[model samples]
Target: MTVPAAIQSTFDDLGTPLADVTFVVLDLETTGGSATECQITEVGAVKVRGGQQLGEFQTLVNPGEPIPAFISVLTGITNPMVATAPHIGSVMPAFLEFIGDAVLVAHNARFDITFLKVNCERLQLPWPGNVVLDTVHLARQLVTRDEAPNHKLSSLARVFSTRVTPDHRALHDAQATVDVLHGLIERVGNLGVHTLEELRSYTSRITPDQRRKRFLADSLPSAPGVYVFKDEHGEPLYIGTSIDIKRRVRNYFTASEQRTRMAEMVRLATSVTPIVCHTTLEAQVRELRLIAEHKPRYNRRSRHPERAMWLKLTAEVFPRLSIVRTVRDDGATYAGPFTSRSVAEQAVAAVHEVVPLRQCTGRLSSKGTGSACVLAEMGRCGAPCDGRQSPDDYAEIARRVARALDGDGHQVIDALGDRLRALAADQRFEDAAVVRDRMLALVRAAARAQRLTPLATSPEIIAAARTPAGGWEFTCVRYGRFAGATVCPPRSDPRGFIAALRESAEHVERPEAPVPAATHEETEKILRWMEQPGVRIVDIDGVWVCPVGGAAGAQESLDDTMTDRGDAVDFDDSTISRRRPGLRAI
Candidate 1:
């Protein structure tokens, strides 16, 4: 191919680096559309130096599979034509050698790059280190033709009045791309965009690494979760969480303009880590727990203990629920360590409707001689003070009230439904109707609060894998729209995947339970109970204890001075350490 006079003079006038620089314009003809399924049938490159063609390289690659009929028609490359051709495995080394130390220029760069990358990955070849310049992106920036409809190679050829022969052939396409690049350099030069770096900036290929890093960073989870970064020291430098952990962490790493901060962090860091949770509810709980434990220097937000409001219920005989402001501590029967008083009140109200417990000011007398309180008059309370209800009956009611307060909606629904059915069977229609309404309301509320997803049903635990560009890409079925995405990581390791799976399963298995009111002594006992198998720490006998394990082991463990209330005995660091190693650090 010969350089036209007008284009040659324009290239010379532009004084761009291309004339003196070694450039390899390349193209590929593949057997099919999908990069994963298809194989490249032809590889071609045209080497240009000092605005003159130095040499051209072209080879037919045996695709190792049958070329699809449609592909054959599109590129005029038959299976038989490539039958005796050199395979990619045999041709790649020479190709790499020829294009050594030269900028790679291509049309629709990603398409060519995808095929190239796939080929390199398959052959276990390290992709050559060369700057990529996309002529398509360059033309888009240089050409100001508003009516040009498309920027296809054919359209670009027409715009530049350049001859494009043997359209789809690899060498022909490479030559065409070279002409397009020359035209863009001329046009951009006219606009005073003459520098090589300046021209390179117009196309995305100039900063592939930066773009890849930014892209992967953006795809990270924008939800409240944990993130960890480890240094070459093999020690963790940062352990933090965010309402949007992925975004927060990505912001730290991808702040390109803030080179000092990012460079320092990246230099100190060798690996990125993340732990995704099912809900923001769990995220907040986990974040607080991790921050208090790890004390990572970068975690400024969650380092401090959060102040929480609690409902203590102080006035009743069985147990009085009092509304109080406090940090999470081991003392009293606390309903919440709620983020806000309003939220605590809302939870209390929800519990109250299902389990009719007294919310009154009057105290219960030992003689049981007090007059009926206002709540008793309204039938909202069982008047235990006046002996209208037995202690055992009131105790049972308190248990129901406690369960409602615990926010175990599934249990509440079943219990309420049974009660409603019993009332209806007894011909108490009005009472049944009220109970039925309450049951329905609770069901609706639970449904709304639940995290229901198809992925949730899978036996395998799911973690939002971070992409190389820093974003979370996952399958989402929204209404009727379904999207399946391939989220590329900056790097991949089998061991990392295995470790992530194990961690995810552990998290899903051990979701945080809502903490209840308990004295310091009771909390210690509860902690002890949790160490036992199949023994969960729950609120029991107006205290937080392992209801199952405590009852089973309490008699055996208790000394003569220690009461059932868990108040007299104190637990030592050794005991706490044995129960929870993580807690011992705190």
Candidate 2:
């Protein structure tokens, strides 16, 4: 059995949520201080899953040496008690088998784990390489210093109301730790920490400034909305959104929100203002808009809508597709607000490969003619400027371009599909991947454009999504932008409630002509919500339907493009302390 360098296990990968993970909570009663000076006297462990005890292991180990009088008094494990007990060499292998492959947890885990590792080495026994967790650190993170007084097992046991109490004994201490671990896990759940990798890397070291700003979120609404953290002079420092605005804002002061720069921003934050919304969709839209408008220094994403490039057909007698930074009201066929200019270009190039459109960037007049470019010379373009093609002939070519870029984008998809196949057949997987990515971006953008293209003059629509909490969330969208939104409590007749919600909802106005990338993104978000199976439509002043064959394959392409995920979490040291500086074990 050859263990090649790259042929390793993938189970260590980062995102196994806490609830799904098995935990082995263990405790050791040792003879003395360090592993070099001490010997294990007893071992106790409880195997747990989702807060339920699956099994337990308990054993007494003979040190094969005299037990000190103080140790005998502390543990109540005298020479007579351990004289009949098996030695550690025999007990160690049994303990290892009992733990299995689950994550190992214990209070002050380093002290206990160190002894086990050293003993395993001396006994020539294989150690189960399980990731370790210290409940003392977990207590420090979940319980405030004043609440616990100290992160000792005893203090945590009292604070969390442990099922059992520790009294210088192995099994009792292990039982207490099991309860503490379960409680801390539930606390971290509120901070969006559902994954085991997240728990392992969790850090709660908020700067003094973040601690002081805790008062700012005290008055924030618990309902859905956007939140802005402002500086002393009233400048926006950071912006965020949540269904529970107060909970989301408060999480910034906890260990789970450990983005280093975020702590610094919170330190400078003077106030927090929440924009309460009727639904999660509205909250998301408002958050994107505020981040774009404020361009907060502390905010990294959703700030620059203008930077998103779109490949749009020009509104002219001789229309040629051009990559533009702005999405405007001018009547033109558009392909994408692609992630980058290169991607937009790839989409445009993909279009040219199938539908021959004029490749010249110049704005040509109906009457004037210019020298033909290389593409026209190569017969790849219509060559309207060279008089090789008449106005009507070029107009026909432009119409093909419009239909290909606008409708279901069958031509564009087919073109990219052909190129991808050619590249893959040639063993150019990298090239094929590039084409696949272009196709994905094209599909996403075309999906957006197709939704708006046919219904450019579509009427207003009111729809509702059944929230997870049994409430109903409603949205009013007109011409692809949100007009109004509302959330209603659970009701017997959803239609009547939605109608009333639509009537009283505050109108979320939008500019009619020019649309920003943020607006497009928000519109797509609303459409996605409306398309969900359980969501119901209450009213329609106009029309809103998934365009035939539009974005139908977009979801599939998204799945294909994002199929590969990064491997599980790896840490530099066994202790979470070394994983993050300024963070200490309890």
Candidate 3:
């Protein structure tokens, strides 16, 4: 199936029956394995149709190179024999003409075809776009080692009682392959493998039970929806959502899928239940919910949403940011469920530089005996630990920090820019670069927090992503969770379906805060989906806040300055936790 670029084929329909097509079984004798270094010494082929021989083509080509000694002895084709023969350039055009749009067959076809393809390139000839089939794969499909002892042409020639025996010479080997191909065709024909495509994709690995399970998907709803596979005990095995529920389930039973675990899961599944969806968006949301709810054994990803870590700003008399592994119902502002603790810390450090929030690990009261730390001594903090800063004074700084977290990051970014300019003017580019990195991290974190905040709090957001195949994939989200997903094919009026999705969106029960980490994850997914080019916001039931001027323009300018290719800031160099939004009303 891996046709060389040198011999790119026009599409060959699999529907072409074996009896209706002509096959040219080819073989080549080469001086070496690689066509670039090696040269073809001989070429041979036998043409046939419907198990009857049509003609034979054989030619010895002057390789313009010495044949390897062992190969010369093996094939009995030496330089002496090829010296007076026509060169490959003269021979190939005739060979191609003989084959013409006929289907090509060979044992380990890549080996023979590579020599031909390379020689054609060397001669500047247009390689024929021939449909190729490998007898090796076909033989393996029908002839097991136990039956043939080995799949080599010599071994298979004896097994099939082939008229011509392989002797390593091109013509004899090609003749043996013709017989072998007919034998395989006959054996596969009994299994209803008549079309070329059936012969191409057919696999013996499918279990009988898997084929019987076809009945499970026979009555599945054709609509976009989530499907769950459950065992006889009614425990969920796996969960997935698809645009066509029936077609997706049917794939699991096909040999075309080579996943061993999928095969095992399909075997254990006693029933498939479909949850018909109004939109592609709802299907996506429901898949996430069901996966989280059931934590199916075979399901991976988002099964343990709580494992995500986030940086939080404590709701206290004197608020300070800290990293938390979970979100909370208590009044607090949150920044991220960052992929790792390391990433979270980088975001935190970026925030501290602008706000001068206390970096001390524990709680300290103004009247308490807590001493100021090194950060305060370095003027990094307002020294709130020793009451050098009053509650009112600290509150003002915290509010600035809160504003930065809520996406009004201009203040901190402007401060960092001023410092960065100063550093650069002083010829301290390394220092300026450090400042630039911190500014970049803060920008990314702030944008992420701002983008997620609305989706996390909104009652509903209906959005659409334009597909490359034409059409829009619509999704409904509620409280930062996936409510549903549906697709709108090209030129189709989506008003009626959009109304239906709105109605279904009502039944999606939103989880109470502390919101599940999965909600934040889903919000991230939808944000990315919406960012796709040609995507549009169809409608919303709540405010979906975004930066007014958009962060992309600013981020691009910084990227141009730094030449950093990363789409998001890698704050690993600075152990700052992600931005925490301003606290909800206390």
Candidate 4:
């Protein structure tokens, strides 16, 4: 096929100045033919400079009027589709910034560009003056001579062997247009079109397709984390967070055409980047921080600036506690906005054992004469409602409470451990037991409350497998003893099970240094803890023993009951299996 002179000239002009030129490939899906009457449903564009892709932009605009049925059938834009979309008026400024000084290119350049200009004029915005390129004209000059009589985007895609699934939506069409342009560029190169000037002149006569393609290959990490997607320019195009980063990023790339913005993002994206996190809470925090700092163009939803509150406990004579939104240059202290009131209360409860502060919602009486609240009776409060404790004493306690809430778990653990050891050494075995249980509880609570400090090392990996009878059973060789097992939920995968085990390992408390020999009673208690709901206990042979099904109908064990020494009768595999008919190895 021979190139038209006008098209050749346009490509030549564009190629002549590589340093100062920018091209913006544009596509729009609208209600109908008349620009003045129809509304723009969606817009997709990619910006390029000196043959390198800069960025991509897309948005769904709510046409002021309803989307006609035929138009909906044509573009798949129903009335409900754009219901929540921002109107074109609101999106224009951001769009203009993205399109600044870039030559416009579209399949039928005049149809889309002229309509856009008219819309701009209606809104009193300046009509863009950048040169326009039409891929339709270019395709005619380049593909028609050798291929079929007509050159629709699909046909052109077939000619170039572009892998475009059938879809005529704006972003999909834009992608196909890009493929066609690549084919033309390759042909023009063979035709001795070398300089930037010659390329631009040829591209100008036909619609120039944006060359950028979104390429996201890596599976996003399933953990809650922040992700940054940069364009070909190495500038951050978007910043986002997901409880499952992999699922979310994959959704963006595989979304339907109606998700024009997402489709456009996939088309222009050059790389995928992610940061793995331990929890969704951590992901949310990091996402907010990154969005506030980086101000990526596509992160429009999270950019709202809002004041967040924190509950502060003052270090003063009265130690006034109140909720404050802003942190001052100097202040008493702060805890959290906590994302919710329930979270705040949970934090308060965690510290109540050490602080003995009043947790009642009602105000303390000024007259210092009111019945002690339930919290006071439970020893969780200092009887502040009745003014029993002095302000100084309360303030001191409040300081400790603040420390606990700030995730100073080490301090609490050490203090509790010392107390427990003291009780045990005094031969107050009953009291020692209570103290030990309390210490274990606090450690578990602390592990849940505290975020992993960067300096804290990752835990060693432990393996566990599910038992056939319905629960998981395994032994941790590192622990030396049989740790109880847990039933795997039907919905959970092996990865999820492993992640849960890792988290459990973090909170798993080891017995005080020299492991004490298990007394009969202590062993019983351990077995009971294992039998609790959601626990599974597995022996070294990977045999699962469930408390729900008591040992019965035994075949091998001569002694089938608890012995006088408080140990169960010894049994071999056959006897054990016969006792628990349904028992199975994991």
Candidate 5:
């Protein structure tokens, strides 16, 4: 079967060819070996691609300190020689611009890269997250010890009979390292290491087992989607998502895939299944759903959103807070879907500190008599179990706790603040820190709930975010569930597309209050995407508002170090409509 020209082009261009990749072979001279306490004296680099030298950058940097006598004698770069040279701070930006996102190659790369990184941090400049290649490691992998006694640049320079000789000087060493790099590439080229990705990940050649499974990626499409790797029995071994399904699956069979478990999975795999989607968000959501459903052995994350813990106020006459695994429609106030029981317990402790609620585990009926625990004796509990506090009186205390959990956490914040202050005044700083942590945990949980509740209750919300390619990515959300996602190209009318979307979108059932339409993690993912910078709410139904004086205010203060309160409720989706009047209606 003949593949179409467009499809064939995508398949052919799986990765950047090694010949096309620009490499900056760099060398640095520093005052000392330790990057932390040293200063760079000189920098040199040679940029090349397709075995042709593009440019060379060499600079003598003023060390701002006296060069050691032995070092000055070694490289001949004296303190007097660098006295008029540019400082490292003045030279770094230009050097960074010179490298320009190219892969960095060096002999003993860690030593050279470390000095550059430490200096970049000292100058408060952003270090480019570049892919660094160590010729030492490469030579050790490719060059046999029989050919050279040691895998040093000088040794390899002789092994390859390079044009440039390695001296102690920076530029000469960098040039020599560049030639060594070409020699290693030539050696690996016969082993089918053709791409930059393969070269970067090439420790040795891909194992024969992994090489055998390369055909698994052949039939997959080059588009945004999820791919499943299944074993001989057809059960899923691993599941993953990517924008380019074919290219990403192909990576699993290459030297770039370093994970041991994945290498094993690929060896045991029988077939690859692809589920294509229209947008990246849809692909992500589908991946999460598939992983949760199949619980693939090789997949580690997003498989158990059900394991999340929540703090629920029990629906009883004498209500008490209980940590729960799931949210239900029990008419009880809920605080979190916290990541762990310990964190949920912290939020529980924060609540107990603020409210005088019963603490006993035994179910206490209004008519039954149960003994008061030690907590009541310490005045921490209402002791309703012993009839010291009436059900009516205990109900009032429960109301205050419920109010705090339902986003009005002003009372909880104030009480914790007073306790925190009292502990600090008494010089019990450790105890004060404990109080501060508990308060922050509770506030963070409450603040998260407040943010999600509006989305949960809303009937339908149409949102769009501008893509980098002058298009817009639209998401249809209903009751906090990601119902559908689509992209509108630049200069196109989104109203008709949105109208079609609303008609064809999945109909999600409105969940009971406090129980989000989707799992807490999934809803939070949607919320995060919705909150990104360029997102605009195109249309919405139902009241989407947060409490004015909610836990959001407390969360803000906690984030800003127990001071500076900001309004927690910024639920104004109308602002987006007012700004983008053209994309307002469906």
Candidate 6:
């Protein structure tokens, strides 16, 4: 689909040109190093544009506290100098007026900016949201240590041979920084950094090879799509998706793209291939599919969907939880596409903590004879391997486990909560923490499965969400797969778009139970889009609902637990409200 001219211009536009930009080089003398404890004694800034001096701002602030002896000696701003001067509250307004909307430039800017921000808060004044530029950062990128030992204002002043030398005074230092800024801009301009946005994103870490490869992005389309960077032999080196293909690919040559691996890939890259899409969702899904198919060396994610692990309750006389790589059509309950085996084990432990499913891995029979393991001895298992527990009784335990994994996690969660309380009451806090972690991991997995399983199994689903551009973005899902997507213009008839979308949508065969129709990541992306705030169900061919008793409820209490850990598959499960059957708006 052709992109609207308005949308293309919005995403493809770059920032202000450097030659047309205004800058306010600033400096401050403070009473102490820490912004929280320190007070600004003097403020100095010079406003310049296109290499011409526009104006200057200078003021001494009465800190309302005695200036330290060392600070007075250093900046030569004794207590008497600021004793008659206005407080920060009075000086801030005039200084702010002088700078206007110019980009703020300072040497070691964090030090100067932090003090100003803190003073702004203390004085209860609104600080202008101006773009800030750090001369020190720019110097570090442009001037190597071999050129100057450090990027300090005095050192940089010497290296650039500025007419104004930096002294302890604020105004002199500010004047010196202004000259240093102009020098750094001139040096970086040689390497094609000629825009305010490019200068803002500049870093010395970007390699020479990357800068030389800027032409690679010149051929990409200026629209929402996927772009593949291919090597000379026609193998994909990297694959990515973006709203503006040309702009996004162009960033690879700039300092904004910091990944070392990607820099290497760009150096090796021969050509870029663009696959523009009609909608952002389509672009994202296509990127995932391409990444999985090609397994690009520089694309770190979504390349190996087959490597995902799942916790399967084995189909045996005695069902036990086991972590496996593949999901199948076999008649057995399944609980995840966990990111790792260790996380899957935590979920298993959570289930075992509440229900007495056999923990032993050995095969069991109703009339079997063997010694009961320590787990059975401690009452954690039913000792089914030794025929001590009848198949019917063990079957009841397995059914509870199935129910827990299948969305009814109340039994499991409630039992664990009780155990947790009991442990805490006994002052076994560390043990309670272990139980808490397992419960959280289990709830996370169950909630994920319960949330997506229904949507994945549905025959057909049509939905629309309000886009930022005031148009409605529509999607057609057949089984679990994203079949088609289109955006209805802000004032157009959505019904026509929906009808056309369904007619042209790809055909998807129904997938068997316990196996998702699409990859776990793909279904997750669709679920997230569907659950977003303004999504409305336009139509449906089958029921789309999660179990009322699902772990989704407990998931709220456990959601925060997944933040710190990398092993658990983290997706938002906080808002998976149970939906009613058929034609409904959500």
RMSD to the true structure for each prediction, in A, is 18.2, 15.3, 8.6, 23.9, 8.0, 5.2
For model 2, what is the alpha-carbon lDDT of residue 540? Answer: 66
lDDT (10s digit) by residue, model 2, range 500-574:
766775554444333421355566566566656666666666544444655545534444445444321221110
**Cα error of candidate 4 at position 106, Å:** 0.6
C-alpha lDDT of residue 66 in model 6: 97
Best by TM-score: 6
Off by over 4 Å in 6: 1-130, 144-149, 166-175, 314-318, 359-387, 560-586
What would the per-residue lDDT of candidate 3 be over residues 60-153, giving only the tens digit for each residue?
9898888889998899998899999898889999999999989899999989988888888988998887988898888888898788887888
Arrange candidates, best lDDT first.
6, 5, 3, 2, 1, 4
**How do these models rank on TM-score, best leading?**
6, 5, 3, 2, 1, 4
Could you tell me the TM-score of candidate 6? 0.80
Per-residue alpha-carbon lDDT of candidate 5 for residues 198-305, written as tens digits (9 for 90 to 100): 677776646756765777887788888999999989999999999999989988877678898998888899999999998888888888888989999999887888
Q: Name the TM-score of candidate 1.
A: 0.43
* TM-score of every prediction relative to native: 0.43, 0.64, 0.69, 0.32, 0.73, 0.80
Which pairs clash (backbone N, Cα, C closer than 3 Å) in model 6? none
Model 2 misplaced stretches (Cα beyond 4 Å) = 1-107, 110-204, 326-330, 365-368, 427-434, 452-457, 468-471, 491-496, 506-518, 547-586
Assess each prediction's global lDDT (C-alpha) against the native: 0.55, 0.73, 0.75, 0.54, 0.83, 0.83
- Model 5 CA lDDT for position 178: 86
lDDT of 1 at 270: 59
Candidate 5 total steric clashes: 0
lDDT of 2: 0.73
TM-score of 5: 0.73
Off by over 4 Å in 5: 1-134, 144-147, 157-183, 195-197, 205-219, 250-260, 562-586
Worst 10 residues of 3 by lDDT: 577-586
Off by over 4 Å in 1: 1-25, 34-39, 46-56, 62-89, 99-105, 113-147, 156-166, 178-308, 315-332, 340-356, 360-380, 385-387, 390-586
Best by lDDT: 6
